[model samples]
Target: MSDTSDRLLGETTNERRASCQVAPGLTFTKIESTLQDGQTRYVRVLSVDFAAFTGKIRATTGKTVKDRERTSDMAGLMASQGLEPLAAVNGGFFDIASEFSPGALGGLTVADGKILNSAANGEAALTLGNHGTNLWIDKVWSQSRITFTPPGGSPSRPDHVVDGLNREPGRIQGCGGGMGPAGENDRNSHPDNLIDARMPQLGIHCLDSDETIVFTEDFGALPFLPGTVRAVLVGADRTVKQVSDTTSGLVAGPGEHVVVATGSHAAWLQTDAVVGSQMSLPAADVRRGASAETAVYFNGTDDAVVNGGPWLVKNGAEGPFDFNSGTTPEHAYLTPMNSRTAAGITTDRKLLLVVVDKKSGPAGPAHGLTMPQLAQAMKNLGATEAVNLDGGGSSTMWVKGALANHPSDGTGEERYVGNAIVVTAK
Candidate 1:
């Protein structure tokens, strides 16, 4: 089939699959096929730049309420406005003041931040900060975005603000606060169950176990050749130990892959090449050239600024980036920024985009997208450079009422998470 035909149908015949061109400088070739439970699975060969995709997790709101019914009401409020619930509701909901709030975990909060006790266990709220921290309570008839400074000292224990959201399986591990059960020191433990941070080396089992290989990031390394491996996962730490030498070295480039072990066990393998490929608007077209200045905006305006540095807009469009209203599960109305956003500014000018897969409604699931499905969906979308962001209970993708992705967790429950990436105009 021709590229145009494939783009339209989203699939191609076996004969044409070998040389399918999804995007510029990206190609998909058939690798292998497998049948499970009477289902046929075909693995495709991917080629592209891995550095183009990066990941990030940012703290949005901190403290919130601790009311279950109020949290449920907040979910309905989000649904009515076309936003996905950020917390999970088991029997309860998330409460910002519930000792497990983001403020408790990261010691970060805004004076007039948005709060929603929409998680399963308690009430949840999301605040919008100003220059510093800001707090806002809609339920309390508050509007103006306020700002404040974070508290002085850190808390002693881990906060459980979004515990109800954490219980849901497939939810990213590190939603509510710090790395979930897997603390930062435990390599064998899961690294906060976020799609972007979900390192295969950190115990995130691949859907197609045969196609996935885990590796550590050795900054000082060369590129691995294609066709020698399937999919590759980079370690969390930015460093990798040399193959024959024990000396720790920096991975040469952002894209180079290396090998890493979890708790003395070979947890993941990495390749010094692109593990996947993606179709991005050219830097020139996106106005992300070397000379271009980076700008950030929230809610489609430049009024709400987070890190007002240089920005690389998609397709050269200033301010609001276009939404992917395409016919794919990965497509959504609002795209959240991943660590790639940070990397785009510091390293390559590439943007990591994500869509919240959940619905709005009092009767909707609270959680966002699951890990396995997200990984597979990204693969299917031809993402050569993709990483999972924080999802589940804390999986919130809100845009004034035009729902973007499907919420898998279901209604009246909110999912808690460590952080999130938001877009606001200053």
Candidate 2:
């Protein structure tokens, strides 16, 4: 953003100064509600100078339940990371109420550039990555597609890109598959049932591509080649968004073929795919109308990156980000109320981590702030841009082995989670 644009955030940088600075750019402050009845209602806020500590602020899914830790015991999991945090919070929605082994629901996640989960096409998202010189929040889009046009024939295309490479039978409505099959109502679908699902969704990862594109499902300690692999036909709409999903036996003839798999269009999409030749799959959301080479004619795969969110703030003004609205009876349901955790950027280029304790009182501001309230609080903190992370029982914060917020689970208790955002004193 330009200097003049930064000034538009109302020049409230450091509006509520931190009481202490423990690291280079990490500071902590205790904010009390300025209301008469808000005497007992307060929040713990942490601020980081993103430019000063570029690459230090990050989002993480601490550990995968692998079934054992459907919710990795939160506090225990944070302590295991070994990096102290200026403040931390639960991240991304998860499979807390799903048929599959619980973990991060659809929040795209990539640590060390290793693809853990990929966001759904055009889903609400928040991203943080380096622009070479500085690590800053980014706006990235995930597009799912496997396109191919046969010789002198029509083309076949799939609309969604699913994460995780598990053909685990039984699909949940809005769990890992995303808000598509769920039909727009963010909270309407039954967590454990499959309603309008596309059958045999094609999965792609680097492994599914030419050996030239290395697949790094378990890229531990390995120099990641994220850009090297343009798009991996990782998994279908099942488990995680990052690896090779169950393949729908693509038996091929030496000559040519074309196929398209869409859940909403038809139950079964069968066609032939020519061996050694598919359409070229390219990156997404890079520019307006700039699509990956969709006509590699079945020669492709799309990228999966970052976590999901209901963007709270943007470009020095309120953003139009929502996960709930316009439902088709099949995808409308009530959303749960709980504590909230959010991330934002200040006018002066600082990063803010705000965690509002849940509503415990019978009602009113005495209870915690609702999503709208949280957004206002972020604006009050002088944030020019912000996004909501996973919250509720999953909401948490850690600092040098000490828990900062009064976790709602119990008196100073915590709920295990699939992931956590950490602050290491690099």
Best by TM-score: 2
Estimate, for each residue in 20-109, the C-alpha lDDT of model 2 and write its tens digit: 775767787655433334423446677877546632545554443222131224434544665444555566555554333355344345
Query: How do the residues 200-278 of candidate 1 rate in per-residue lDDT, one tens digit apiece?
Result: 1111211211111122121122233222232223323332223321112323234433322211122222222122211
Give per-candidate clash totals: 118, 38
* Candidate 2 wrongly placed segments (more than 4 Å): 1-18, 65-86, 131-140, 144-306, 319-337, 359-366, 410-412
Candidate 1 deviant stretches above 4 angstroms: 1-59, 62-348, 356-373, 379-384, 400-403, 413-418
lDDT: worst 10-residue window of model 1: 138-147
Score residue 304 of candidate 1 by CA lDDT: 18
